[model samples]
Target: MATSSSTLPSLVVRMLRHGRLGPGLATLDLGTGAGGLAAYAARRLGDQHVTSIDVDPYLTEAASERLARMGLRPTFHAVDATAEIPGHYDRIVCTVAIRPGTGLRTVLGALHEGGRLVTTLAGTSLILTGWKHKTGELVGCIERGGAEFMLTRSGHDYPPALSELFAVASDEAGDETGTGRYPVMDVANAWEVRSMLEITTPGVQSRYSTHDRRRTLLLIHADGSWARAIGEWTDPPTVHQGGPRRLWDALERIRGRLNMEGALPLYGAHARVTPDGVVHLSRGQWSGSLGEE
Candidate 1:
């Protein structure tokens, strides 16, 4: 009951394309919300070769029941994926985003040698794919057209939400409001731009709204940082920001960089995650990292 039955057809197709599925190769689908990906895999790789797991018993039960009706029965487990899995697999595709340094090592341990695991990072929209080496590590990169998924969780519900951060952001007015150098840009809607902003500064959530014909973009972080921009995107918007950090300026800087470079930096970078879950990305001098979870 903690999950809804939903399917991103495009995401399923993209995941399958990069999953590297082959005949007779055992596959594991982690976080099987409604078993869409598992059923998709069952069609290509056969039900006997697929195993799907989720932390919610209701989800597992519902998925198992649905698959049975289709005459395709895949083994389903209502267990935590961050813990030791019941068996090994040739390919592990996680539908939920995994935080850096959080249970990624254990998931990799469940893969056979040279097996592939595809997942997105928790804080950013970077789809990472890696091959498990006999040396007990996974090396991969930011796949093209990155994905966003629900964060991997153990409990029935998400943690006490971002309400506190949003409350502060909605009320605070500390920094000066001035004409922005660039026209108001919808940064959150642009995937590449949003991904760059996220990787550069994690844990920032954005909310955009409109009231009485005027648009507003609000930026909030758990660290008491907040910023707001009000006006049309094509016009110079008034920006008000406060807290320990300059949030709007950071976004403007990224927009400026993208204007010069013609693209964001994260899409094609090489990613290397050690067993301890330290993620390093480098493509030329543009190197960055996601610290341990």
Candidate 2:
């Protein structure tokens, strides 16, 4: 089992301060893993006021022992976070990744008006602090940097196996595949694009690799469409593409536009999250969304 990183304590503390947690603010640490964040918050705000909870009794016991070593006694509860949260809290911080339809609306309802909730959506760690702008929108931005956390264990670690969706093709056949090129905007800095697509687009994964002897390879996907490119500059790139859509061509067009404009901006892109965790992206007149099997 991997432990939460040591830097998490200070990171959580900074997020707390960013969210404006003061001397009297009530704090709840959800998924308190080894009690690292709990202990750090307790020391910062005093143990009597911090409440820590986890679904696993063993994790609770380990957190208890860890807190004891720090000479801090924060209340620890063994309860399923997906079910019900004990009481309303001024600030709720979760150290686990939340999937779609995990009762996030219920958890958000538990926060007092003007109270803030900080947690990870999918796998990206974000700090959302809003004053309940109304009934529907809880608007916030991604915290300065990114943080990684483990998923809660309500079931087995690995999800049930997925049915085979594609047949493997020979390298020779794959090499002869049709290719297209598009000018791609700088997506590396676009966290929103990455997070939204990962959530909405099933089977979509990306890999970024730079070779010592060649240009970098940035791969993007969804279902059958696969796009691969070499080098960051120069058009008519070496591209190997296959599938339903000419994905490499789409990428080339985006890249060409980026080169024309001198830069591609990701913030101008629009994102929509479906109830089923699918993400749709639209920019200017071009748009695409994730599809299910």
User: Which candidate tops lDDT?
Assistant: 1
Per model, state how many residue pairs clash. 0, 17
TM-score of each: 0.91, 0.65
lDDT of 1 by residue, 219-244 (tens): 87778888888877467788888888
Summarize candidate 2's per-residue lDDT along 120-215 as a digit string, tens digits.
Answer: 555333333444334433444345455556655553243432223222211213433443354233344455544444433434444545545344
Candidate 2: misplaced stretches above 4 Å?
1-7, 100-103, 123-127, 133-137, 160-193, 199-203, 207-293
lDDT of 2 at 115: 72
What do the candidate models score in CA lDDT, each in turn?
0.81, 0.57
Query: Which TM-score value belongs to model 2?
Result: 0.65
Local distance difference test, candidate 1: 0.81
* Residue 142 of model 2, lDDT score: 41
Residue runs of model 1 more than 4 Å from their true location after superposition: none
Model 2, C-alpha of 206: deviation from truth (Å): 3.0
